[model samples]
Target: MKRTDIYPMPEFFERYINLTDDVELKDAFAISLQELKQLPLDKWEAIGDKVYAPDKWTIKDILQHMIDTERILTYRALCIARGENARLPAFDEESYARHTDASNRTLEDLIDELSLVRASSLAMFNSFTEEMLQRSGLSFRGSYSVLALGFIVTGHQRWHLNIIKERYEVLG
Candidate 1:
């Protein structure tokens, strides 16, 4: 499936869509996994609780957010692909960051969990048929397709990784 297959693009998601270059869903997923695997975990650990600015997320917080958001997007894709019509609610990232115990966990641990999560996501997405990939559903922001959600998952990670490179000085 291609990004063009996603109908009624959610306005808020345009940035993420633009960040992605791959038009094919499988290629997009593979690129996302490759980029994630190349993250400089050592540099992230070296930074250690450092936030680029006041009231900003720490490196650990960003990593945790990536994992959390990936899981949420994957779930949304699954639901949409299954033809669920429920309108999903929005999540408060700041609130989630504050409440999460990511600070207690090592970067290595988070990365490992992220790998597992991505693997599960791959398995689920790999099972989707073309019709399933084109399925759409209501969300807090707007309508989204299973294919778009898949791309969003990848692009969202790319967006965060760019921030990490620019703000946190973590080499990609």
Candidate 2:
């Protein structure tokens, strides 16, 4: 799915769409990667503790949501990078949200989980060669270049960060 937005979802990642194959999307990924890694526990917890606006999610919920997204999108990216040609299965985000209790878990734990997944994802991406970046494959959304699939990691993260910062944090 191609979604454009006003902030990071669109702007921060705008550089990726024009980038030709063989360039590391990791440089783009690195923009927010470290800062996201270093976000204080207090900040992460604050998102959890604040009461969100009507119909929005708590900071904890947002973090939990991002954690879930990282798992899904990275797997998709990896599958494409690894030469998978079949269509990936779709998952229901709303159903998963109801099954997990973001409220019960500490914000620190959620942050830790994000850190772990991101670390794994970074390692996975770093291991890919320029040839791998040029690989072609299909995902649940249909066919895409391996290079384009790689950009989804940071693009998706930046997408949610925009929501969290502007809506979840501000409105909370």
Candidate 3:
């Protein structure tokens, strides 16, 4: 499904969804993955745990956050597509980051986890039929379609990539 098919877009997810192009959800994932794999890892490694601002997440932390969010979004899509009616619980990203051991992990390790999680997400979304893709479910913010979740996953990745480039990359 195309990004434009997402009707009555949930307010909270607008920023992430808007960052993506109005393309097929599968292609959005591919484009984002290609962009991710093309990042200058050597330069990013030089930045290490440095944060552009105080209390901001380091590169590794950001990578871990990406993996975590993708998994959550993918699971939400799965549950929604299966006709789940329960309002999914919202997660506290800051709390997850605070409890994470991303600080002790290498950038490579975090990136690997993110890549694996994204691959799983890609496979899962690709399995959904057009009708399943249109399935919507209630969340903490509001209702969201399976198609929107797929785009949000990719778009959220791009959002962080932009921050890393504009903010963190300069630190190198």
Candidate 4:
């Protein structure tokens, strides 16, 4: 399904969704994955847990955040597609980042986890029917369709990667 297929885009995630192409969900996933795999790991490693500014996340933190956020969003999509009316709880990124052992993990390992998560996400999204894709559920921010969630996953990665490029890349 294409971005255009999403009805009433979630306002809170507009910046992320806008960062993505007007392509099919599967295509968007492919492009995002490719971009992720091409990231300059050597440079990032050289930075070595440095944050560009105070209170900002390290490169590893950011990568872990991306994985965590995607998992939460994908789960919401699944619940919504299955006709669940219960409102999903919002996740605390700061808490997750602070508490996780992402610091000890190698960049390669984090990337591998991310790739596996994306693959799982793609499989889930592919299983949804047209009707399921259109299904909406209330979220922490607002209502979102399954298709929108899929695109948001791609765009959210794009958003963070852009931040890493624009901010973190300049540090080293």
Model 2 residue runs over 4 Å out of place are 1-23, 38-51
lDDT of each: 0.83, 0.64, 0.90, 0.91
Residue runs of model 1 more than 4 Å from their true location after superposition: 170-172
> What are the per-residue Cα lDDT tens digits for candidate 3 across 83-138?
99999988999999999999898877887778788878888999999999999998
RMSD of each: 1.9, 5.8, 1.0, 0.8
TM-score of each: 0.92, 0.75, 0.96, 0.97
How do the residues 26-130 of candidate 2 rate in per-residue lDDT, one tens digit apiece? 665565467576655655555555655565667777778778877887787678778787887777877877778898988778878877877787787778877
Query: Per-residue alpha-carbon lDDT of model 4 for 46-68, expressed as tens digits?
Result: 98898989999999999999999
Q: Could you tell me how far off, in angstroms, the CA of residue 23 lies in candidate 4 after the best superposition?
A: 0.7
What digit string (tens of lDDT, one per residue) describes model 1 on residues 133-164? Answer: 88888886888788888888878878988998
> Which candidate should be chosen as best, given TM-score against the real structure?
4
Task: At residue 33, give the lDDT of candidate 1.
Answer: 77
